[model samples]
Target: MQGNKSEHTIQKEIQLALSKHKCSVFRTNVGKVKTIDHRWFDTGLPQGFPDLMGYRWVDNQIFFIEVKSQTGKSRPDQLIFHEFLQSHNVIHGIARNVKDALMIVDGGLCGFGYD
Candidate 1:
């Protein structure tokens, strides 16, 4: 649907913005691999792994970002991962768009742009 496409577009924008940050930022892409039985399976990264994981040197903090569309929902694994991050004392959250991602990056004070 139109919403899904928009969501992905915004995700790409967020990725680009993250890449431009002065701090270390990396995005995750889960790919499918062949199973021992010869069938393709989604098994590279752990289930619910965040879309982006990186470290911010300024605050010496590790941040995990799960980018989603404005109307997108997180998977079960993602929720578990969020909880795990919290329990482990790591900073993590779901970002619906570039602005949200910016907030995660520097509390929206760094003026991260999507363009």
Candidate 2:
């Protein structure tokens, strides 16, 4: 049986493409952080932050991208976050692959991968 590409691979491709296209992008690392001085670092980031955050220079648009594999789906928390962003007029979408991600960067539209 043919299997889908790993989400990690897709995420890497999306990041590379965005960078290649001159979009200022970065991945969001979610977890706990403790400094050597026992200083706890926590911003209390909400759940379901997108995998990639970037600013597309062409339109001067900021975006949030949630990457997933062919068979992957968004979690409840992700959907909630999406809605929240929508309410705030933030650009965000779910990208199932490089193409989807690129499209999001182009226009922030969740064409085929978003439900």
Candidate 3:
């Protein structure tokens, strides 16, 4: 939230948080980020990526997250994925902080197109 974060940076935060709970985190590769960076056929072509992917040991549930600063421009691809996640009931969002990330997991985010 305070600094610029690449997908890798978001992934690291997730990794650290998951570690505290002894949960395993899955990080997205640069290639994956580049390839699916957004929704290409949303009445447009998809081409974006998710910042982080992981399964919570406590819930045995998987999450797909896209992090962002509290305020700024959101990538076009992120908007596409937001819709995708909403319809699919997967997790996704523009989180500003580690607490924001946790909220995504605890169902703190709703009606924003994420599970």
The numbered model that scores best in lDDT is: 2
lDDT of each: 0.69, 0.79, 0.60
Task: Give the candidate order by descending TM-score.
Answer: 2, 1, 3
Could you tell me how far off, in angstroms, the CA of residue 64 lies in candidate 2 after the best superposition? 0.5
Higher-ranked by lDDT: 2 or 3: 2
- How would you encode candidate 3's per-residue C-alpha lDDT over 1-115 as one tens digit per residue? 4576664565577668865764566656433222365743232224556666676777777776666554445667666667777777775565556766677776635324233
Please provide, for model 2 over 1-115, each residue's C-alpha lDDT reduced to its tens digit, 9 standing for 90 to 100: 2146787888898899989997988988755689999998875777877888899888878989888877888888888888888887787788877777787777666333557
Native-to-model Cα distance after best TM-score fit, residue 65 in candidate 1, in Å: 0.7
Please tell me which model should have the higher TM-score, number 1 or number 3.
1
Give the per-residue Cα lDDT of candidate 1 at 29: 75
Evaluated against the true structure, the overall lDDT of model 3 is 0.60
lDDT of 1 by residue, 7-99 (tens): 557667777887787557777877687889999987578888887877777776777787777667777777776767766766667777766
Candidate number of the best TM-score: 2
Model 2: lDDT of residue 77: 84
